[model samples]
Target: MIMHDAPEQTVKYLSLLGQQFPNQQAVFTEIINLQAILNLPKGTEHFMSDVHGEYEAFLHILNNCSGVVREHVDEDFGDTLNEEEKDNLCTLIYYPHEKIALVHAAHQDSPTWYKRMLDQLITVARRLSSRYTRSKVRKAIPHDFAYIIDELLHTHPDENNYRVRYHERIIDSILETDSTEEFIYSLAELIKVLAVDHIHLVGDIFDRGGGAAKIMDRLLSCVHQRTDIQWGNHDILWMGAAAGDAACIVSVLRNNLRYNNYEILENDYGISLRGLVSFADRTYRGGERIDPLMKAIDVLLFKLEGQIIYRHPEFDMEDRLLLDKIDLEAGTVTIGDETHPLITSDFPTIDPEHPYELTPEEARIVQKLVDEFTGTDHLHSHIDFLYRHGSVYLVSNNNLLFHGCVPLNEDGTFASVNCEGTWRSGRDYLDFCDHIARRAWRDHDRDALDWMWYLWIGHRSPLSGRNVKTFERSFIEDKATWIEPMDPYFTLTHDPACCDMIMREFGVQPERGHIINGHTPVKTTSGEKPIRADGKLLVIDGGFCTAYHPKTGIAGYTLISSSRGMRLKAHEAFRTVTEAITHNADIRSETTQFAAAERRIMVADTDTGTKIREQIQDLRMLLDAYRTGLIKEH
Candidate 1:
């Protein structure tokens, strides 16, 4: 409504369209007079218009003549319009036409007023659609967003409705609940099991889920209907989409099918679900129509919340800013009125997996997308980067968060973490960890990768950048168990270094405090072994996130306390623990499809495993390194 100036150019073009149909019959007959015009049989017509009886435009048009909106425009077919054509392509439809069509619609959401318009348009377009070439039809339509119900059926929400973010991590119960209501209902159960105060989101809350719009509306309705939310990758993307950012839009288009501009929507113009129905309604009348509402449900899911669930136990402003930095890199920023970013820009398309180098134009586009990436804008947020929301780090009173180990000089002495809090040892430990985490993401940095995985395997020399990426393949694929040095694509395996870095950089390491973290998804132990080669490091990321595992359960998160040390717990209140864990991974029979329970990080338990203890030692190495660093600096 705020954008309703209907620019002068739009007025001029709309006037021209009206002039084309001077008389009511000129408009009405376009439908019934199909056979002679578009090469159809005697029974059909073309150029249908389900006007809102008054010949004036109304909101009902969004539903009545849904096809050919901005999102669904195709440039080549004469259906797609440029930025200018988009404003100028309005038509004159009478309300009466849509009311009569009501009888044809199966659901009530297609109100009586809109139905009449649809019915008439369907009859006319089918008969005459043959006459006009696709080029002409495309030019006439301008935007694809007009076709709402049409594309929904064509895309077949049933097939495209699988998961995207919730892939490998297994969380049962998440897939069963259909509506947002059901999702919220089960969420409480997941939270109880996980043991968190509030959920954190990374961003991207739109464009890939059922009832995405409604879910978003509900999430925002905290004051309206009262709901809790954690940002996710999709949410920030939605912000950009709603604000109409072409960069973010294009990235999503390349990935998703339901909203792809080129392949599915028949144009690179924009989205047009309503326009799709109108296209079908006119082109193929009386053909079994797919359920548009069902399709809309899928469209709504891209706006889901609670995906990255981070909670803060307690902290001051200065510390919060540090938290923001980690989230920014993770791509979970969330600033209001912010445009979505192009994820492919700053980060390599596949981070060393890219087949070809990008040209300047392509690179610019990527940069534009990445530039607009909005990190969290919350008063408490510490980060300031591109689009991010879901990815979060909690700093509870009892828990500490850090990324790397204390630094080690070329001679292999220790460098102090020197960060903050009582017992400042954690701070020094944190620094060395930082070095490894960064190294792990770098090329041929086996040491860092291995450190993160808590595995002490040495790497072959001259590990090429290409080879480093190859080594990381298993780590990214998350099948570290089956991974071997021979596979060497660059191991996603583990980098004990990252944890140390996070702690020292953010000062999450405390002398006497426990720690909680995400990011590192490696099993705390391997075989029955304890190889504490490098240093003492502790990693608690037992793979609580679905982005890693298709079958990761709900309670992968851990809790460490001096009273009983640390233990694993489930996030029972998180709607579908399975859905939460799986993120969007396919959830077949949980029994057969899922296995390999990543053990929770446990301290002081017989089952803690040698790797866990080894990790603890690696964490300690960070402190030692930091201390040495302080000594050298002095």
Candidate 2:
């Protein structure tokens, strides 16, 4: 029989593949493994948005895996363990080292207590491990306890009577070796790791709640699991600041001062506010109701912002250049058809002819702040992680995740945005924004750094869906002038077809895909629902920061996509971490399941499954090559 020859590249690729598989036996083994993996249950995806520096809340939710850990405990011990016992077990998994100490204090280091806790924890771990391949579970275990954990999870006492004694002896050994605490800690970690397969942070991991750096530190430690951040406008402001944008740097400082997040800047990131403090003291007097530092930073921010606006006429934010419109003598600023009275007539730094130019003193202070923000290694490391693990948007498992709107016109059409001299809309515009944002970090040129500022507040910016009224709100006493109008996309998204069009534009099947949004808080207090567009879009930002809790009527919203289906959870405010660890105060959450009647989802339906199938095909090809003698194998 005549055999057909393969292309040169195909032959070379198969030859390289043979190096990994080596022989037909190895190829067959891998193919079988891949096939088995394809039939397993799909891993759960946990989606959160607008964490907004609520580090304690975010950390607790993360440790609990959005209550998946508790659910596991409830499932395994619902009938066996009482409510108090279950709650304690859940708390133990969340803070093992701390909870263990407390347990020792109350129970006097009882061996009976340690042994009971270990058995219960192992049961939960084993249940979670059943959903994953043995190899994958082993990889997630700590290196020091990998062998012990693997054996404990996989070896069932029911397999043989000998195995029963073996399991008991292992637990007894752990108790005798004074390693109960260590073993329990390892089990707790493994349960946490296995509960949630992937974490999707829709956006706004920085700003507001005063512990963004702490939140970043916690996220950085999760090397064992998958996590991705979709950049929010607030996150972009910090990114731009880290990239040396003067406007962005002061904007960050302004917010920190405004929200009283001075500790985050001065203590966490070690950025000195002394320069601004000294400058504010010398610049502003005591009569103003606003803090002197707030007034000082606002003036500096407006000047820097005006400079950027003057350079980029394309930004169409000429109206925001209000310093030029200020009449210092009258203490009023003309804004288009209306003239609003300034809250204060303190314009010591404004030169009538050059309203955007900073005075020599003002320039020196802001420059120092810019240098400090850019030079801080800790700040840079966190921002570097954001750039490494974040993006403009993410399409995972058919759902499109973005921090803000897909800018739309009033007629429910994708809005054309002029990005980098070219007009693009929808996905194209977002792609351009993403490209320029990366350039802002990579090149740090004048234009790119300026683009980062635009992404933070520009009306056309998809990341920032509303025209920010920062200047108007700060200076003008008129509440009417402080209304920041949202983009048409916010209104247009009320229509399901509009959301479907957005999904299709992003190359997702509208019927199955949902747009996960973050920038806007869903006002549940005022009878607003996060699920909108007939379930085509979900706004998961249920106010993670305290400021919006009154408006949103909930602490936060998290989405879970598991093998069963998707669900949205509204979590009540986390009282305090101390309360959680001591009193077992888990964030009381109400869950709303989406399409609960749908068929169970399996690994064969996932993105990872697609890649695995491709691998299986490649291995089959390598096996053929080995049999045909086309490639030699060891």
Candidate 3:
């Protein structure tokens, strides 16, 4: 056993652990189990970022494990299955129920087809389950077919004729009972479960696309797979809105409206936008007034944001307060010596003397919206999931996952930002923000809710490095004023030293660790690569949102890290799910090997492996104590 800090510490811990183990046999059994687990292959981790509410695309990727299923099919079937047959099998694995229906409709020999498909599924399931322990696989198996799957997966036909007969008996029984469909579905799900051990949603699960709620539902249902989310700026905005922050609510509404995804608000979460919609229609009713209505909501969002800035002076976001600078008479807003023409000058709700103050009607609309945001049960449950399973950043298995920049200054040092009253930077700042975000949800503190709003768009907010140029982009004609300078972190990402500094700051090994970032979509068409700092950092937001597909020229990126190595999969834009189902069209993906290890990584090399080793050490000490008579065995 490796020597620890002190022998006395081990003695103390053994005394405590003795209560559970009680005997040498118990301690030895645990040690044996842990030792066996350490030799198992490390499970694959699927890292996705900037989903932006493209539920169909996101769900498809999750269902297919970013083409891992097809890869497995090729590996297992080889020349036996043709390309078209493989595609059909892959689709069945992804959408089992639908694919089964399609197969039934197409084939007249139902019994023969079911038997053949079942054979193929068991083959795939057996290969997928090879990396995991029998105990783990048994736990993943559906309760109804637990014994049957266990027998099939473990009992090899080559072992003996008896084993072959046993497997055939199980298959024959399944077919006789007409349980083929249920068994196939269970096996497909088990294959998916074994394909990826964990899912890392780097950020931006909401916005732009129409299916954030659907995506969340999928995540929630995957009980067997461990999932973690790093909160993105867009996610934080919605979180703040759910906490009843008016600024956040207004920002969410405006963003949804801009993307023509109002259904996400009204239909998905059941948040009533009737009051705001009515106000917009009634206030801006002249010809060509829809644009004017959007502008009014945009202005209201700015005012609401300004109110938060006013309340928190230490946020250093005074520059974002542009509402008071609008010269309604000139039909222009002067920004830094440039007076740009407004897209729409009508502002029936703003008070020029007190521009940030919402008029009675505007206030009523905002209050109603806030009530809907806070009162909705589904929104609360979704936000609760986010708070429970997410953070501003996460460091897992030597990789640093975050939604945005680490908030760096021009000098490439961590930029300090006010967290409540105290200033923090780097990991400290992120930890504080994460704590406050959870507190905002748990206690519903007004101060924490405001901070969440700050995190949504504040200049120093790591999640929102660029100033949200909502006002200027909406009202100003000059594109120059609309420029929101990116935080220096984005530019510094190419520097190995900068990447090392970030990794070290987050307490991960600079040489071995990687910073997985999202938010800034990688414009691959513009020659911008996702890999930075010679592969030490990866910016993986490859335009999951259709709004960004034109700019990014790709669907998105999924970084798959398994026992073998790490690879980045760049996918083309996904067509509708209907097309994928009807035509068996899969998202075309190109895989680029990012990093490959000299040897396959085992469980002993993983974070969980570290814990298992520690437990083994403790058990050893307990055994020593028992033999030495220092602790009596039961």
Candidate 4:
């Protein structure tokens, strides 16, 4: 080969790449490894939305990978294992430590049982790991069992009789050493790890249910799994509170109190409510039998909300400024043209002339709560994690994932939003909102912090698809006034053209890309479908919050996007973890696959493949540099 002179910049880049490869042999070997990986089947991507703090259900669904583990179990053992055996095996996989104890308690922890389960688990793990490279599989294995797992997974018993004896001896040694339980636990966790290559939380990992903090803790603990979150409106509220937004702090307090989810604030997050408890006790007593804390928080919430509306008139939320609409004398509030009787008229904290102004005590309490919210390290950590892994929307593997709608006009056009002095719409608007959220958290900008509150409830906020009827529901007796009108996007999204427009605006190919959303509970009881826009969009929020189980008629939804295509699983309510561990009860899921064809998608067809190809190209360039004598090999 003739040596060629290279450009200075090109030499610089190739020389840097040479540090990792160092030699032509290393470069060529890596090229072969990456090329082989590209031909393997693509890893499974699990998508879940609107967890709403239901930690038990979310945990179970995550562990089971929305029934994908069960599918594998049934597929691998349908001919051999009975129904009872399969169910037990799945439960074991989900909660290994607990299931093992239960088995031990039942006197079923015999060596025979250990060998059988190890054999079965090893087989399933091998099948699951086949899609991944040996190095990737080794990395997923627990440190203590890395050698054992790698050996068991690679050794095919059917390939040779000697391999069977080798695998059996390892299991027997584990059984003899009384390490069966620990080894099984490790394998079970490894299986769970390999079941889903990536996790996409479409949004709402907070509020409604009491386990928001628990849910955040769980996600934070997932170090190995690739996970991303799309910010949900409810999530934005908590993020705002963590950034010390008074309106958001008051709103969070009110919602938690109203839903009786105070434990999450007091216990899980260590946010003190003692001040509010005292304030409520002294200021909110009346003929109404509602909890005084609830009443107090509601009054405080409205006062803060009114202030925000007045401060940001561009928010177009004057309709929510109902504090001044109250007629104390008649115990009624005028909404639009109608006057509705008030449910409670005790307004010791409100002044008719300055109704949005907080009373001296109210001001003190609100400030203290804001201080507490921003001061909590746990809250900040969770909020920081949210900011780190989350955005307003994400485009991954030709799918658009967002917690809510792309705000739209009634005529099926993207709605324009004014952020500061500039107007943005569609994807631009969402990007602006996402930028503000980060500024609120990272820089603690006052305006950005306030924008966080707006994102939670502003009429045109893409995160909040509907006008929140909090005030009406709190004060007005007439249910008509409490009907929060959803944005036109909610209705217009049913049109394929509208979804295509959204996909195009986000720079995704409309023909193959999907808009994945959450926020609105799909009311299956009312004959509603989660799939809309001729399958261009999927709303996976099937009510993970137990409060919505009645309306949604299901536990929740988890979408599995694999090489085989997208499949939606509507899950039945997961019974308590205790029941699941004790009685082997699982959340039964109904799977619906919507694929145009059953083409086995390989790594070469995915975003990961695109990245690997780039790496290969760079390596090949380095190889060229070496052969051409432009760069010397190590």
Candidate 5:
């Protein structure tokens, strides 16, 4: 792990490692050999950051020729009793010395991805001519590879008609056009054909679009085929919502299964639409239960993961393991974890006996989402939930990583009030109108769960309880002044354009990374862009499926790094910021202008010119909306 193993050799080894192994064990074995051949003093710390779901990468380091992992091939090490061998099996791969430690790191804190990759490694080994691990060492067998179709509904739905207002967005090569619709559709298609070594979905497979049902169906089919990498919160919201609306959903499920030629007896199958009722009924059958209580508590703490929903079988005061597994305390809900947040009585429901109150519509949405998740996925409360005990702390490294907010809670309060408030760093703000929506849905007065908090942290509603100007003004009074202020839904695209503004309030290292985030919704889709909040931040949320277009091949992200310097680039889908902004702006201008023209006719100062002007206005609106939203110029 010595930092200096001849940078050239290290680079060459990386290249070979990338090529030689299609799984983790093979790669790690190579790493072990490489370290031995290099013969560097042991104990040097080597950190593998964010390996993610890269199965081959994992394998390449674990089992390969003359590679670098830990100790391997007892024959290669000579079986000589050395002090290092006596102490640690892993460290014996090297010369055995202090000042060196090899470690692996991930952006999101969860070992589920690592475990899944480990499974893939085992699978690859099993399929290969040579075995990577001894037969005695094999403890687990993977069922299948994960095939995630992100934003499935947003993709090119078979039902899509060539009805886009923009000429460039008319089907073929719409990736270049400027519509949100196009962006989503394009991401969906592109992900299916990405060049990455591996692909995985981190969650949010539903909501905010007309194609929710489509995405859901596609996801179900995909899960049936591949491993479920990330079970995001949107999935939980829907599961919760479904619980209150299972009757209709169950009917839909039954119809869908029947259409697929899958027959069920007694309507109690795991994949049944009435799936939720039979399951819920079992968990709540008066008193005694065979499964963990979380299995029965599916109606609360809704979640989706491992292609299943884990509700409590029934509440048990002594069974803390089930409760601990439920993740209601303070852990971060990353892509792989199996825990879920608890829907406690601490938060009110719409019922008269509930702790809090909610309007009818808000109540309905929550009920529907919960039920949908549990019924469809069999919501399991057995997995760990988000922000249970983990505190949020900001890191100076890794491109100034921060969730959308300024690291503060939505109520302008200290974020660490609870485990949920624990941020690594940075703040969390309630986006525009989501807080209102949350408030409407929740019995007002309940602190939001991580799912709701995550959604509103950066984006705002046009009707959020607070105003943007006022929100921004708060930052002027304290260290918090560095944060942008906006109510729900009020877009902040233009705020960052007023010359340059400093992002770091306190001092940071020279190596401190640049800031990057995913929160703000897309602006005009054409090229030229408007900088917001003085350009201190860049929003990378291309409405990423779960919102507008889930399954389209138009999804990608902005890459920001100090090593790369201050620049933004899109991958696979939209190619650049100018393309996205210009497209978005053009459409908005057109829509605004058309609405105005329609009204101008009634106020006609000059009736003669009014009709012609209105027609032009309508044309301009139609043209501009297309011009902005589509990525045609790309």
Candidate 6:
């Protein structure tokens, strides 16, 4: 084989490509296919942040695509279907098996109802499928009923009475075969897949709520749509614990206990907390008082954090080592000029000489907890998925998605952080931390594990932009001492110039790019806006966690970017999935139009489109080489 004169790299790339498509005809066909794909409308992307283990709300949003399914229903059958029919149809699409059971219980004529519902589902599916190519739609169809779905979707009964008979015959055969349940399930799933092209979970998939494990299971089992998770501080805490970090294990347990989520550890992940309970009961035995036990655990956590700081002085978190400053006899902790009374001086596990040292009992309990965390197959699988699909930050489709701030100095410049004696700032700093976090699990590196602990509470960590203030919140009574100032990035993010710098640093076009972030909840009740920097940055964490609902006054915010443009939706609280299925209740959402494109966006204008364009170029070059007689057609 011969080739035209080209650069060495180009020739090498083309030679590799030729191995797959060796003939001119194959190259031409691929080029044509790519061209056709480039002409299709861009797929919809759904963005939600700070789920915080609210699995019902999260699952409901995912199922209905932040109310996109309802919008599609309204658009497709605005006058044909009334509100009640639309609500029932949407519920069927959301919880197919459950809704079907309810329908069977309620309806006297089951067959007639099934046929009517099937017809409605087909109509909705057809409307959703219109945006995608037939090949893509076929791939999304369940394998068991692939042929049947393809036949139904392609054949139009309205074309003629004969076509109507054809459609009726397929439904009758399914009923006769007793396959209606399976068919309904497959169709509902297909409708969900067709509605949203991709899901972006911005951060905080763990903590507060009790259903993180359930949510993880749902995401892991997703086959049709794609999902990417931006690791939040809460998520990283659990990931570090799963890697067997002692401090992280304590932090996770402390948080779970504080939220009254012991069942999540015991029942969900099979993590036994009986040893900790026994230890706590024996050490702070006083009429089942949780406050004393909580104080003891909080002190233990501070000491563990101090040990990490002591090990790495470069972390500059010595101010957080408050155990040494506590006078156990006086029952007080001295900070700066102020000495505050301690709530409880019941830290029996803490040693005065070696304040950060874990006592024998505490050490045993920690070891058992670590074992429980890392030994559980379900927890391991969940963390493995996080490592597999999650990143500290993501740049996709001209947008930056991250869980927290980019650490910045008071003077509005990127803060230089020391990582193992090397100073890094901006994107380089985040990349360094991400590398260590993965290595903590993959290589079982001790330094990496310590760094994971550092990322949890370090002053310079982007995940934790402010001091944790756990000790201040627990021991100190003064409200002034409880203040944990946010990083300057939080204030500077409101400035368009600062946002432009961040966008440029991340290699995204500043004019069109946006930074989508979470971690801090948006207090809508207090009249706080999620959109910042005049639309250049967006903080979409409207508090999906029920604990934060009091402050936020809303369930959450979801950003939907489609062919038309981007829209931000504020959702009210979801009562329960049972209420949704039985009562046909959906989350009441208020949507605001953020941006609308002058022209509809196509595949050629997207990130995926860029990659397809490159492939087309290579194919064209290959075609030219074959025609020029420089390369053999075979």
- Residues 1-634 of candidate 2 have per-residue lDDT tens digits of 1123878888889878877889989998999999999999999899999999998899999998888888889899878999999998999999999898877678756898889999999999999999999999999998878898888887765756787788888999999999889888899998999999999999998888899999898889998889999999999999999999999999998887778898989998889888788888888876787767888889899999999998999899988988889999999999998888898988787899998899999989888888898899999999999999999999988999999888888888888977768989989999998999999899999999999999999998989989999998888888888899999988888899888899999889997888999989999989999999889889999999999999999999999999999889999999987788789999989999885626778898988999999998888888878878888889
Question: TM-scores of the models, in the given order?
Answer: 0.26, 0.98, 0.96, 0.97, 0.29, 0.96
The runs of at least 3 residues in candidate 4 whose Cα sits more than 4 Å from the true structure, single-residue gaps closed, are: 1-10, 157-160
| Candidate 4 lDDT over residue span 470-579, tens digit each | 98777776787778889998888888998999899998899888999999999999999999989998999999999999999999988998878889999999889999
Per-residue lDDT of 467-557 in model 6, one digit per residue for the tens? 7788888777678888998889999899999999999999999988999999899999999999999999999999999989999999999
Whole-model lDDT, model 1: 0.27
**Runs in model 2 with CA error above 4 Å?**
1-5, 158-160
lDDT per residue, candidate 5, 193-224, as tens digits? 11111122323333332233433333343321
Off by over 4 Å in 5: 1-205, 209-372, 375-397, 407-512, 525-536, 544-557, 560-567, 570-634
Q: How does residue 436 of candidate 5 score in lDDT?
A: 28
Give the number of the best model, judged by TM-score.
Answer: 2
Supply the TM-score for candidate 2: 0.98
Better of 1 and 6 by lDDT: 6
Error of 6 at 243 (Å): 1.1
- Span of 10 residues, lowest total lDDT, candidate 5: 586-595
lDDT of 3: 0.87
> lDDT for every model?
0.27, 0.90, 0.87, 0.89, 0.28, 0.88
Candidates by TM-score, descending order: 2, 4, 6, 3, 5, 1
